[model samples]
Target: MKTRIQELRKQHKLSQEELALAVGVTRQTITSLEVEKYTASLVLAYKIAKYFDLTIEDVFDFSELEEI
Candidate 1:
């Protein structure tokens, strides 16, 4: 999934480690998410969106992917 994570993180002046710590993930996980190398779990996505005061759809773009 395409996400606005990197952009939002930068805008908020947050490092990947900080974001990961806030959301209870490893730095590598945040790195993976930022680079689109890994997809986040539903719970992780929700946590991230909530931390940013955004809905999941605002953080993750699912327009191109088929729905389950």
Candidate 2:
């Protein structure tokens, strides 16, 4: 899935480490997520959304992928 994580982080003036710390993940995790090499769990997603003061739908979208 593609995400606007980098853009959002820049908007907030946050480094990858800062975002990871805020969302309770490692810097590598944030890097992986930004590069689409990892997918976040629902709990992680919620934490990220909460940190950004956004709803999950606002931060993430899965419509481009088809169901299994």
User: What TM-score, computed on C-alpha atoms, does each candidate reach?
Assistant: 0.94, 0.90
lDDT of 1 by residue, 10-52 (tens): 9999999999999999999999998999999999999999999
lDDT value for model 2: 0.88
Which 10 consecutive residues of model 1 have the lowest summed lDDT?
59-68
Candidate no. 2 TM-score: 0.90
CA lDDT of each prediction against the hidden true structure: 0.96, 0.88
- RMSD of each candidate? 1.4, 1.3
In model 2, which runs have C-alpha deviations exceeding 4 angstroms?
A: 66-68
The digit string of per-residue lDDT tens for model 2 on 1-68 reads: 87778888999999999999998999999999899999889999899888999987788777676564
Question: Which candidate's TM-score is highest?
Answer: 1
